[model samples]
Target: MKISRRFAGLAALLVAGLLGTTVHIVTTAESADAAQTSLRAADPSVLRVGGTYVGVQSVGDNGIAVRQASSPAGLATAAARTVFTDSQRLGEVWAPEIHYDGGRYYIYFTMGAGANHRMYVISSATADSGYGGATKLNLPDDRWAIDGTMFVFNGQRYFVWSGWAGTTNVEQNLYIAKMTSPTTATGSRAVISQPRESWERVVGNPFINEAPEAIKDPNGQLHVTYSANGSWSEQYCIADLRLRAGGDPMYVWDWYKSNGCLFGSNRSTMMAGWDPTLYVNGPGHHSFVLLNGDINTSPPAGSSFPLMFHAVAKGTPYAWSNRYWYTGSFMWWGAITYSRANVPGSTTNTGYSIKFFE
Candidate 1:
């Protein structure tokens, strides 16, 4: 498998974490102006087209912004030509990730409020035309699900999302199922990852393992990154997992996780009541993009890749406006395998310690 096109874009996310290993990462713009993307960022998602960064984000209750981000940091500032709006209950429509497949653009987003929140999709031939009429997927295990994303492996389409294990909300877990089409799931969902780590379960009662994003390494291994903890708190962070070599993705025994959070809270120098942007908090809900070069070309060992995400200035409430978009680059350590998936999760099949930006 080649790299994810999502990785082909510029750094479109801001994440925080210090994996216990010597990493050759270039993380800049650690401090950013929060007011820029304010109500526009919550679950920020974008795709790079040529030199332009195109994205869709929550505008407000019942609204969406089909945005042309001027830069990774310049969301909400760019053209708002691509958008979706409805008076019908879209209650805090969040995590709008855009993907292009078969020469078409598809926006996968979460809509509705509370338990009513579920994933939906809209498409347009070109982003300039704007997406229309959100449609929910016919999922077999259709419970409370959100942050749904799609990936294709060996020509087979698959859907991964964060959902409640039961009817009532207890905790959010990562699930994968076969997708007959972009808008339909064809089989029972397999539970892959959950909030088993203490850092992942920090407060908000119901722990989270949301925002399952897929990325491919140069070696053709399949891996996914996810957000952990509560988004409402500064404790919110990012973690990841990978499929075992030659392991069946549908089986719970096929996936493994890192020892700890791959991306979490950024620790930086601070003064008393430091600039909110100076020390970012809870860098999560992000997507990956290949910094440069052709997506099909296998980058040499230790090539730097960019990432972007929404973050709040330190000491600020986790409000919509407080959250801003940030960008940076990190180097990959190739396919070097040292540590193992020492952490616990749904499967006993521990994998090689898969590190991101290390």
Candidate 2:
């Protein structure tokens, strides 16, 4: 049986404790969305460094956990082993993202409870295999931060994450700052995007804008997709921010918020597709591996992008513990607009559309 090489990379890594037959993402919509595995882990991030595949997650309240695979296909069977847990057990350690650059691997995550939350990083020569002690990332103002992710744009490295503006537990806004090094962020943080759209302000205690992920398209548009609304609400979904042309990356006015969530609750009718999961809600806090064939590692032609996120199963009576890991095969249609019922004029090249695989 011929299987997709791109889909194979994420299939194994997400199935940690479950058993499943080999499957691909190119099948009918029914099989695609039905092919989910309940990893029961939050804030999943997977990175392929050379031939090694490493995944980091907030498996527990104390610290970061890791699972590795020697091959992309081996990710399906790799077992999770906690690499870092707070000895002091300070607060809920959530949204740990693993990134690689300059021959070193870095894992950035949040530590401490509520207002005391701060972004921290730990690195090893390898990908968290020999991870050392955690070092608090030095951000300007040292505000409460979480879900720190790093990306290099225009030959300079930059850091982005969800953080509070002041000392209060007010709204969480998406912020960008220049990173002098992977472990430290330099320059003042720029509040690029926040909860402004009506859909973004849906279920709010403090109006959310957390879990910022950076992706750059072929057009040089630095796209930052963040989660909006309350994390536990069924309205918990993914939204976008694109750095406009001739715009400075660090400037707040340079970024334009997209019209809607890339993928929202099935009840909201964001993207058009068959509902294979019975009830799928809160698809946010994701990590994406784009098989663009130029950077990182080259792949065969027709390789697709993989977006993995945690989502709650049912909408009514939203429960935090009910969230599980799910992945979508991201397709790029270039200049063609996706002809979906609800998402008219949506282009898969920009707007979000995915085919779940079983």
Candidate 3:
């Protein structure tokens, strides 16, 4: 099994402080348009130092609830809003991966329906405003799906998630779908990885593989990671696929599971935690935030927020235990790094810059 993982270099983190430095913009197609509402930026900042955040129970039994610190150095504050609270129709919304691209913010998350959950897209002219209604993509064959993450490789975008090859639900496989747009997918959902492998299997409910997150290294290698086994004792694992410049991303996503678990259950450099989460454990399902501070500053902006789920203490390194949190809840941001470092094959040389539209 091939896995592509990168470790970043030790560099200073910078916080932007110039006026006009902050911008909020959102644009979308007409038919799917919903009311536009302004989102509030929590004071003190939720992603603070030594703070804790916990996911709020559903107010009306719908949508994910998130809370965090107000300042980079303060106590966590709480807040909630229904992004997609139509339980009778959409059911529970989970794991929202927020992205900022092309002057707009696109939030990709899993929405539940009846016994199955599929991925959907919501947009806001601004990163932290009330997003318009969602557009659900018809996942190939309508297999039970969840944990949808949007990724861009070599200038092209793709969606990766967990689903069953057939309807049995006994085997949840990792699949990728090509995107015609942020809200729609073209072509069939291709199977990238399956739980049948010895390293991918687990024992319990939802018994299978799920939740895939992919990122590229400075050398342009693609690293995809996901969680397997039952949710209660969930395990986080990673694998790799390579994409050459101008190569079809779909073809580049060939499946090959990693050698072992990156972090989960009893194995990991980081302590094992349920949800087998990532991207800075916060208010939602396995999420990660990339705050690309100025290349010359220290402790970059958007660096802290409250803890989530279990309400543990914050202030540890961003990659500390499963208890840190952040409050931006929603906001517009940008990163300016040319390539990712610490990835496998440090000797390989390749570089590219990424500018996402949510």
Give the candidate number with the greatest TM-score.
2
Q: Taking the tens digit of each residue's C-alpha lDDT, what string does model 2 give over 1-358? A: 4344344345433442244322232222212343335477677787665456677777667877777776333444578777887987788888888887777778889999879899988888865478878898988889999888888877788998898899997788988899888887887899987786777887887999999878764445576778888997777887667665456888876666655666676445353322223446777887774332112231113444555677776644567787776755443212212221332222233332233332
| Highest-lDDT candidate | 2
TM-score, prediction 2: 0.79
Lowest lDDT sum, 10 consecutive residues, model 3, at 4-13
Question: Which candidate, 1 or 3, would have the higher lDDT against the true structure?
Answer: 1
Candidate 3's TM-score? 0.57
TM-score of each: 0.78, 0.79, 0.57
Candidate 1 to native Cα RMSD, angstroms = 7.7
The local lDDT score (0 to 100) that residue 4 gets in candidate 2 is 49
lDDT at position 276, candidate 3? 32
Task: Return the lDDT, model 3, position 21.
Answer: 30
Q: Name the weakest run of 10 consecutive residues (lDDT summed) in model 2.
A: 291-300
lDDT for each residue of candidate 1 in 1-358, tens digit (9 for 90 to 100): 3223234212222221233432223232223321334433667676666667776776656666676654665655676664677557657677787877766778888887788778888888887575679898876667888999887765678888999988889999998999987778897999988888655666557888898877665455577778887888777777667777776777765676654565556322111111112356777787675322122322323333456677786677776567777664344432233233444444343333222321
- True-vs-predicted CA distance for residue 194, candidate 3, Å: 0.7
